[model samples]
Target: MKKNLIKPIVAAALFGIATQSALAADRGTPREARELFDQAVKFMEANTPEKAFAAFNDRKGRFVRKDMYVFVIDDKGVYHASGAAPEALVGLTVLNTTDAAGNPLFRQMIDSTRSAPEATVRYMWLNRVTNKVEPKVTYVHKVGDYVLGVGYSAPRASADDARGMLTRAVDLVKKDGAAKAAASFNDRQGAFVKDDLYVFMVNMDSGKFEAMGMNPALSDTDARGLHDAEGHALVAEMIDKLKSAEDATVEYVWRNPVTNRVEKKRSYVHRVGNSLVGVGHYIE
Candidate 1:
């Protein structure tokens, strides 16, 4: 009698374990997140910042409004145009604007665009109308010798909305067992992931590479063919050579062959049963 009872208990435990494992297997893994990030970057690059800026400036631009100020800048951080005060910022140097520590708050963004034609950055400024400090998002584009920037200010309420959207997306991905979820900034349709060192944009339709902010070296072709390109091939080789285990966290940096600027990224690939999933920052 005792042996019969033990067998049934063991069988029940095994059944429970199998059910849990199946549920886990059904959820997506980190690989899904990495793929989405890659796709978003490709989409961003296909749409050049200069063209995007022009569209924003057009009469029918999506962000054209009195409450929202859109503008462009140069490599030297001078204002190219400001929807709110174009004339006032025409000659002003943005680098001069510093925080209490005297650090150029825009340092990372400015450095990234020095070579590449486009990049994006975030900052805070005082709203003249409301007399309050607010956050601003700017997409910087380099054309010839000058840099062009398009920007919009977020109200406190809108900031909450943006954060909420991102959080919800992240939660959905997590609940679905996805390793990552990718999305574009509200004003700039470029890709950003929680773990990426920089943002990336590639054109979705044309398959053209546009810009990489964290790494300026990534060019049109480099950004376009990340998965199959020779550069990424070398990256995979390096990972295999130095990786401790099949599951090590690896960093991959690709410089544009033309600009020699670097785009730094990290990814972790894992095997769940027979399927492989990658998660991490492909686009920052």
Candidate 2:
């Protein structure tokens, strides 16, 4: 009986993991955001605004799950309902509100929806629960006099994509020197940053950040003592590994920008002159 039960239990566990992986992938795509927006629109059409607003504003509503949430705004960019925003945002005009990157995301959303039935926009936003800035891709659709939107945390770049970015960065550093390469890394819209994967450099001697493609604020700071979620001194480990060779790889638990959860990350580091250029990809 034990042996028979073990086989079925193992199969069930594998099935559960497969199903969850599919759901996770679905929730992180633009199609999912559009679908959730459509659901919010249907709710408003079926019920009165008061009833729909109550449902949409619910923190745990069907329209708001995972990292996606539905927000409703009037034609003039006044808030009608927000699934996970603070209560102070309701009934307020937010046309000028900007994302963490100073991009007028609300303004862009309004501009796109005013002319089209639906629009897709990308911006950087702060995850309120995690207090971390992350990239977001939002889908907005105009319904009657309201614009309904659902935004998903952007997906992480694949390991192959991240490896390619690192290769490019390494080649650039070899040809252009560290100063010129730092300029490229500073370009947030440049090739160094591809989706969720970005390049980071640290001066081996000074132990200071020379450049960070993801967050410019992290540049020019001492980061040698940086630790992972489990108190592992990740930067020190990288530096130690690079002391004997030109390249090294390290793995640790890190907060994933897409999921805002501590997950395993594998990083590739290359010693380029006095600086160490590296890139990492989260492992799901």
- Alpha-carbon RMSD of each model: 22.4, 15.8
| Per-model CA lDDT versus the true structure | 0.41, 0.76
Q: What lDDT does model 1 reach?
A: 0.41
Clashing residue pairs in candidate 2 are: none
Compute the lDDT for candidate 2.
Answer: 0.76
Please, what are the lDDT tens digits per residue for candidate 1 over residues 181-247?
A: 2233211324432212233333333333333333434434543345533345532432343334434
TM-score of each: 0.31, 0.52
Query: lDDT tens digits, residues 151-171, model 2?
Result: 876656667877888999999
Lowest lDDT 10-residue stretch of candidate 1: 178-187
Quote the positional error of residue 269 for candidate 1 in Å: 35
Candidate 2: worst 10 consecutive residues by lDDT? 13-22
